[model samples]
Target: MDKQNSRFRWVVFFSVLFTYLLMSSQRTAPGLITEQVMKDFDVTATTIGLLTSMQFFVYTSLQIPMGILADRFGPNFFLIIGAIVTGVGTIIYSLGTHEFVLFFARILTGIGDATIWVNLVLILGQWFKVKEFVRLIGFAGMTGSLGFLLATVPFSAWIDLLGWRAAFFSAGIALCLTGILLYIVLVKKPRQLFHNESVPVKDEIQPQNVRMLLKRIVSNRQAWALFFCHFGVVGVYVGFISSWAVPMG
Candidate 1:
């Protein structure tokens, strides 16, 4: 049972990993579609900026609330819903004939994208041992980097062959299928009871504690460096690789 459960946990890990890949791909897909989208909707450069920027905006603004909701409900719930919404949002974006509709589609995609990673952390915490958790996070980061990598050359070719609308819709269909698999497999896995037993739950946070936590992170030079490292490295990577790489290349 232990070995079987361990294998199953890894299965769950890959599922979430690929979902994270999808998240990364979705963020960058706008870059591939930028020129086509602009011509299709008859929008300006600023509007294209705003449209692509909306995903990050929704992702950044919702982190705190998403964490809270994940705590109250469950990480699995968010992962499933996020996948479904992401698919629906992509389909919506694919079908949009007007600028306003496309703008709203980006907002919807952002909302769905915002919920993914935090919940992934929670789900990983539940399934892996303490030491394994750190390694798993590194693996997740690597997968995310691959996502950034794949979003350009292959995705661009896909757009060329299928055209942007069909390409977006194909991804949406795949995402929805993955969401269904996630819902079926993890929700009722045979090892679910043991998985629940192994994972430790943290103490609930008081609203007031948020301030102290932020202050502590802010005061630490090491922590600040890490923040900037992520901002500089990951932020710049995503912005360029996902958004501008095709055009630049």
Candidate 2:
């Protein structure tokens, strides 16, 4: 039984990792096909800039709302729903002719991508204790890094052979299927896994009721300092890479 349980946990971990890979692929798809998009839409660099910019805009704006939904409705629910929405958006993007449609599709994809990191973190917190947190998160980060690595080379190869639309179509299908699987396989808490163990009954944690929690978190000086440090470091790194790397290529 212990072996079976361990196997089950590993399966769940890999499934979540696969979902993250798909999310990363979707996020980077536009960058992979920037030249094709520019030619097909007959757009200037500025327009392409704006379309991609919308992705970041939507992702940043939706973070808080996605967190709330994940906490209130459960991460699996929102993550799966987000994946479906993202897959639909990718399909629409592949079929899109006009710039407006493309922009809309990008926005949807961004919203979908926004659900991934937060929900995964929340899920990890539920499954692993504090002692295991760093190691598990490191493993998750490695998965994300692998996804990014795949996006650059393997993804480009697929786009070259199949064309961007076909590539996106395949990706969309994968995301949709994975989302369904996650919804079916994922349980909200550890107690849900034990057949004989009595389930703990607790009040549903509402987003609105989280104001006090938020207040406590925000009032922590260390938290504020950590937030700014992360924001400054990550922001600078991502911004520099996003702006400079493609141009250098």
Candidate 3:
């Protein structure tokens, strides 16, 4: 039973990993569609910048709050919600004929994207031992890299064949289907799946401790170093690879 349960956890991990892949894919998808978007909306690159930034801005703004909520509740609920919202956003973006609709779709996508990674961390932590968790996270990072690569050449080819609307609409449907698969396969706890009576529920963080939590995080030099490093690397990638490079080429 132990071995069987342990094997099943990998199934759950891959389900979430696939969702994370979709998240990263959509994050960089605008690069391929930039020309079509500009033509459709009769907008400048400046407006395109705003369209892209709207998703990032919302995703960044919601991270802390979503993390707290996911900790209090559970990640499974939020992950499902994220998948649905992301799919809807992509579908809306595909069908949108107006600038206002496009902006709204981007915001929705950002909100969904915001809920993914922190929840992924929570899910992985719950399901795996520390060493296994570390290795799985590295795999997750590789999955994201694959997503970025897919959003580039393959996604561009897709757009070229079907145009952006059909391509993105198909992507949206795929995301939603992946969410359904996640719903079926992801168990919040190993005990839940395996019927282990000895397993204990994890303690939830209290609301009042948030201030202290923030202070501790703010005071951590290592955290700040990581924050700056990630920010610099992501900033350059988003600014160049995901937005401008395609058009320049």
| The best candidate in terms of TM-score | 3
TM-score of each: 0.87, 0.82, 0.92
Tens digits of lDDT, candidate 2, 166-213: 988888888889888787667543335655544245733434666887
Clash tally for model 1: 0
What does candidate 1's lDDT look like per residue over 1-249, in tens digits?
452346788888889999889877888888887777778778887888778788888888998889878877889989888888888888899898998888788888898888888999988887787789998999988887787667787888888889989999898888788788789766877346455453224634334566786788789999989879988987787766544556444
Q: In every candidate, how many clashes are there?
A: 0, 0, 0
For candidate 2, the per-residue lDDT at 11 reads 64
lDDT of 3: 0.84
Candidate 3 off by > 4 Å: 1-5, 187-192, 195-198, 201-208, 247-249
Per residue, candidate 3 scores C-alpha lDDT tens digits across 9-101 of 788888899999988899889877788788878999999988888899999999999988998888988898899899999999999999889
Worst ten in a row by lDDT for model 2: 240-249
Quick one: how many clashes does candidate 3 have?
0
> Which candidate wins on lDDT?
3
Cα deviation at 173, candidate 1, in Å, is 1.3
lDDT of all the models against the reference? 0.80, 0.75, 0.84
Q: Give every collision pair in model 1.
A: none
Q: Please give the lDDT score for candidate 1.
A: 0.80
